[model samples]
Target: MSKTILEDAIQEELSFFLQAIHECVHTDFNCNRVLNNAVANIISSVVSGKRFEYTDPLFVKFMKCLDENIRNIGTANVLNVLPIVRYLPGDLFKFKQTLRNISMIDKEIIRPFIEDNRNNYDDSNVTNFTSAYIKAIQQRRQEGQNTNMSDGNLETCLRDLFIAGSETTATVLRWGLVYFLNYPDVQEKCFQEILENVGQSRRPSMKDKTSLPYVEATVTEILRCADIIPSSLPHSVPHDVEFRGYTFPEGITVLPMLSSALHDPDLWGDPRNFRPDRFLDTEGKFQKMNEHIPFSLGHRACLGEALARMELFLFTTSMIQEFEFRPVDGVSPSLQGLPGIVYRPQQFNMKAIPRAK
Candidate 1:
C-alpha cells in the first residue's frame, strides 16, 4: 500500500478515536478497545482494501475475539511444549478457545474476504496485500510452478498481518500512555514540539516527523521502554552455525531475546529510566541506535515495522497535540507488564483532557 493511503486511513480513524476520547474526558477510561479498533482498521485497509466502522457489529466481535486470544495465548502457549495438556478435559489454558477464536475469525471475517478477492481476482486490480497474494498464486498456477504457496498460506499470511499488525502497534500506544501518565513532563515536551512544528490548527502528519525531533524521540523511547515482544517470534537456524564458541544446530528453534538488547544497560546508561533524551543527540536531533531493536533485527524482523512506526508517530503526536494524558486521582498505573506473545501493559485508566487548540 502507498504511504498516502495508509496515512489517510490513519488520519480518518484517528478522528473517530479522538472523538471517543473526547466523550470520556475528565472520566477515567481505558483506551484498549478504541485503540485496537483504530489500529485494526488501518491494517485491514492495507491488507483487505477495506476498513470497518468502529461500531460495526461483526468487526467489534472479531476484535473482542482477537483481544481474548491475545490475553489467553500466553497461558495457552504451553501447548507447544506440552502437547498432552491440550487433551485435558477442559479449556484450562484457553488453548481450545484460542483455536476456536482463530476458526471463528477465519469463518466470519478473513475467509469471506479472501473468497471475494479470489472470485474477483484481477492482475491489474491488485491494489492490496490480499489481491497481490492471490495474483501471485494464480500466476504460479498458470506457469505450472507449484511449490509451498497456496491459498492456506495466503490466509495464514493475512492472519499474521492483522494479528501481528494490530496487537503490537496498539499495545505500544498503550505503553506510551502509561509513560505519559507517569511523566507528564515528557508528554508536555512532546506536545510542545508538535505544537511548534505542526501547530494546533492541523493534525501532525508523517511530513512533520522530520521537523519534530522531540516527538520522534519520544516515540522511539516508548518503543524502547515498551519492548512489547521482548522475546521475538521463534526463528529456526537455516544451517549449523557457530558464533562466540556456541554451535547452533540446523532447524533448531531460536528465540532471540530482544529485551537483552533493548534494555541493555551498556547501550543506554539509564535504560531503566523513561528518558526520551537518550534518543536525542548532542544537537537535539533524533538519533537512531543500532542496538535499539524493539522490532527485532535482520530478515526475520517484524514485517510491519514501517507501518507500525508510522502509526506510533501519527497516533502519538496527534494524541499529544489534542489532549493531556493525566493519571487518575494522581495515581500512575503500574509499570508491570503482563507477559504474553506480546508483552501487554497492565489494565489501567486515565483521562485525556483536551488541550486548548
Candidate 2:
C-alpha cells in the first residue's frame, strides 16, 4: 500500500474509534464490534478499494464469516487430520461447515470485487491492491509465463489478507482495552506517556512510537499476557533432528508449544501477571526480548507483522490518549480467555470516558 493510503486509513480508523468512545462514555458498551468495523475497513480498502458502513449487512456477514473461520481453525477435529473422518455420521466435524462458509463468502463476495477491479484495470491509475494485482497478472500473461495468478487465487489472497490483517490486530486491541480495565495504574501510566509525548491535540502516529516508551511497553505486555495464539500454527521437522534428547523424523508435524516460552517462569518472573515494566529497563526505555514472539518466528512467520505492529501502536496509543477505559458496574473481566486456535477474552463491556482535552 502507498503512504497516502496508509495515512488516510489511519486517520479514518482514529475518527471511528474516537466517535465510538464518545458514545460509550458513562454507559456500558461492547467495543468489540465497533473496533472490528474500524479495523475491517482498513483491510477492506486495501482489498476492495472501499470501506463499508458499520451498519452494512454485508459487512456484518463478513465479520461473522471471519469470526467463525478463526474459531473453527482453532478447533481440533479428527476430520481436520483425516479427511476420511468427514464421512462419519452427525456433525462430528462441524468445523468443515464453517470452513465451507468462509469459502462461499470469499467466492461470492470477494470475487466480485476482484472482477470489478479487473474490469477497471488501468496501469497509470492503480487505485488499490486489487487493481495493482490485476496489472501484475496481465504483465505476466504478456510474457507467456506460467503463473498461479487467477481470479480464484486472487479471491483467496484477498480473503487471506482480510482474515490475517483485520481480526488479529483488532483482537489485540480489544485485549489491550481489557488489560487497561484490569490494571488502571498501568493504563494511567500509558495515558501519561502518550500525553507527554504526543499530546492530546493530534492523533498518535507510527512516528511517535519511539517517543512513548511506556505505551510501547504496555502494548508489548498485552501481547505477552494475552498470548493470542498460545499453541501457535503447527510446524514440521524438515529432516531428522535431535534436541534435548528428542529426535524428530523428516515430514513429521510438530507443535512448537509457544505457550511454554511465552509464559515460562524463568523468562518472566511472574508470567501470569500483567506488568508492562517487564519490557522496560531501569532507565524507563523499552527493552527488547527474544522471548516476546507473539507473531511466531522464522521464515514462515506472519507476513503482516509490520502492519500489525503499526496498527497496534497507533490504535493503542490513540485509545489511551483519548479515553479512560473502565469495566462497567465495577465488574472486572476474566483474564482466562476463551480457548481456541486463537485465545480471546470473554465477551465483556466497558465504559470509555473521554479524556479532558
User: Best candidate per TM-score, number?
Assistant: 1
| Reference-based lDDT, each prediction | 0.89, 0.82
- Candidate 2 TM-score to native: 0.92
Q: How do the residues 225-261 of candidate 2 rate in per-residue lDDT, one tens digit apiece?
A: 8888887777897899998999899998887777888
Measured by TM-score, how close is model 1 to the native structure?
Answer: 0.95
State every prediction's TM-score relative to the real structure: 0.95, 0.92
Candidate 1, superposed: residue stretches over 4 Å from native: 119-122
| lDDT leader | 1
Residue range 1-357, candidate 1, lDDT tens digits? 578877887898899889888999999898998999999988887887778888899998999899898788779879888999988898899998989999999899898888888788877777678888888777888999976887788789888888888899999999999999999999998888887778999888999999999888889999999998888888999999998999999999999999999999988888889999988889999899999999889997877888889999999998999999999999999999988788889999998888986
Residue clash pairs of candidate 1: none
